[model samples]
Target: MSSLHDRHRAVIPDWITLYYKDPLELTHGEGRHVWDAEGNRYLDFFGGILTTMTAHALPEVTKAIADQAARMIHSSTLYLNRPMVELAERIAALSGIPDARVFFTTSGTEANDTALLLATTYRRSNQILAMRNSYHGRSFSTVGITGNRAWSPTGLSPLQTLYVHGGVRTRGPYAQYTDERFVDACVADLEDLLGQTRAGVAALIAEPIQGVGGFTSPPDGLYAAFRRVLDRHGILWIADEVQTGWGRTGEHFWGWQAHGQAGPPDILTFAKGIGNGMSIGGVVARAEIMNCLDANSISTFGGSPVTMAAGLANLAYLLEHDLQGNARRVGGLLLERLRAVAAGVDAVREVRGRGLMIGIELTEPGTDRPAPDAASTALEAARSGGLLIGKGGGHNTTALRIAPPLSLTVAEAEEGAAILEQALGSI
Candidate 1:
């Protein structure tokens, strides 16, 4: 291991995992590529878990930060912050919720936590409904709602989170069912869960596409059907779009739009890509629910001017250049290419995802069981071939996740896919 990694392990918590057998310290990045501390160049397929929504070091975002920093950085929530307000206004308009109010946080965990806090308090219940394989965040509140055992460090929880069915499409009990039947089964299961559970369930929070649970997603319109059940009980719906928002999913600006038949969620949470690489997490809710909290609260680092400026410029670039369109066109190509490559590989279990968020699941040659070992081999091989990617799955981190910057070009997609093909071959 490198001396830096040794030093990191000595101080940093072991739970904060690093990638690859020998971790890479990325020193700089531009566009879809990054250079490691040792000066090895690699195609960055994960974009730091899709936080770099646009290309790395985009001049617009960099300059905006510089300009904002020159003026000021922090005024706290107590004072007037122009950039933060501007960003909140922009987000409120973009949020599908009517009469929506936005609250910024420092990370996705904080965003989801705030949503949970609002939900339970507004509804006056500590009960929550979460998908069986969903992952929300790493905080106490979020971990309680997260159903994936691998991610949740403890069984103790502040909220009585009820696990529901229907996030994973290919491995769950309802996997064999058709899309129509799958939706029906999941909806039926949800109804049963509600009937069997205690009264006053605050909300059914879900990720449109489960991020850390792999890039798995329920069938389209699945949530719409669930919404019908939730409505009958007056239960709210919260969409955790942390890793799936801002056109990363290509077809929809928000992942919830894939199930738009139910209308927008009562609360929508987002973070990863909105500020490019800057830390920007937030919750958008209708005025009724947001204003429900009686006590005062504030986030010291939530909407700092510097980060808000980065968010504004990054959002503008995403809109003006139609990065969503780029994600669609180039991501579609990459998906097709990966699928073709996976077809000939015996260890490949499935290839799935939308837009730039793709996952290649590895199994034991012919078996359907998760091959985390193979996943590790594939990761190392990919790195050897000068490609940096990511890993995630409920089944012990068995899926290789490829989510490049939304600004990825067709050429970069092809190149990354080619490298992935080689990596899979080696594994």
Candidate 2:
């Protein structure tokens, strides 16, 4: 009989990448570990691209899913959904936008698409500003604004997008500048770009931390500075918090809080961790922007009872247990430990990130050139040592991504760090 991998290869699209040369099929998970099909357990560091906000097989979330499924699987937006309304109320209260309104979708891509629709229609322009090295989503409309070439599949787009600087801090032309100077230069660039564009540019959409672009981000106040410039031009600011929301960043509940001087964004798009592995994504905006549409809009399965139950339970667990505080404590230690380990490895060009989202950038020893091979070798080595991690980068996939669940314990962090240290030594 043909192997499962062979069967997958025959049916699945070639562009859907797998992690290993011989990919391991996950069978089950509990807490911070997952067992492969062959029954080999490995420490899970990437948390399925940071979608699992809490521990794997969390009882609260699992029970909520089961109970909801027993009662009702789904109800379209045409009908009243108690669970959906309750969850939306919670999210709206949490969102800093005044007079907030919420709209649900099944994934981050759909959420961003909705945000784009609202911004473009409300502002009466298809022109947009996107940060360089940013990854929004896989949909056609989103791919147009994605500044990362590796992730963006085509040039054709419904909207006109202008790429901005200041997303990546270490390798750009302004890398050598101080944080203040870097922010100033980027603001100046934005000013110049707006000067050349039409007066009706719709909005500026950006991720608080670029997730697929190797977890890169600008200085703390970069977005605040940009917000000031945007206010002058009447441009809406959309914060894509798919990977950085729900206290994954440790110090802040939302990544945009790191740039809190400007208050909340005009629009916020979130997904991934909110449902704790359940498919729940949404857009939050002020009443005016969200209600701008002249016609009716609804998501058939977006606010399904099952997913809403999962989200409510997951969010409640996250808050009740103070997982954000746990993330701050545990992630701080892990970051320090990883930085120490990277300091001894010549291939590690930089270790950058905040909270639970961290990246280790690999380069040729004693040089600035990207070392994708080194990253690959280290990934395999770490897997061999019974640890599962992830790799990403705009520069040829040369960065290792480490984003464990927010509920990870300190002991788990130490163990993963040790395995990573061994893997780096091999590289």
- Candidate 2 residue lDDT tens string, 1-427: 9999999999999999999888989999999899999999999999999998898999999999999999989779999999999999999999889999999999999999999999999999999999999899999999999999999889999999999999999978898999999999999999999999956789999999999999999999999999999998899999999999999999999999999998999999999998988999999999999999999777899999999999999999999999989989999999999999999999999999988999999999988888988999999999999999999888544799999999999999999999999999999
Best by lDDT: 2
Off by over 4 Å in 1: none
Model 2 spans with C-alpha error above 4 angstroms: none
* Candidate 2 colliding pairs: none
Name the TM-score of candidate 1.
0.99
RMSD of candidates 1 onward, in order: 1.1, 0.8
Q: Counting only residues 3 or more apart in sequence or on different chains, how many pairs clash (N, Cα, C under 3 Å) in candidate 2?
A: 0
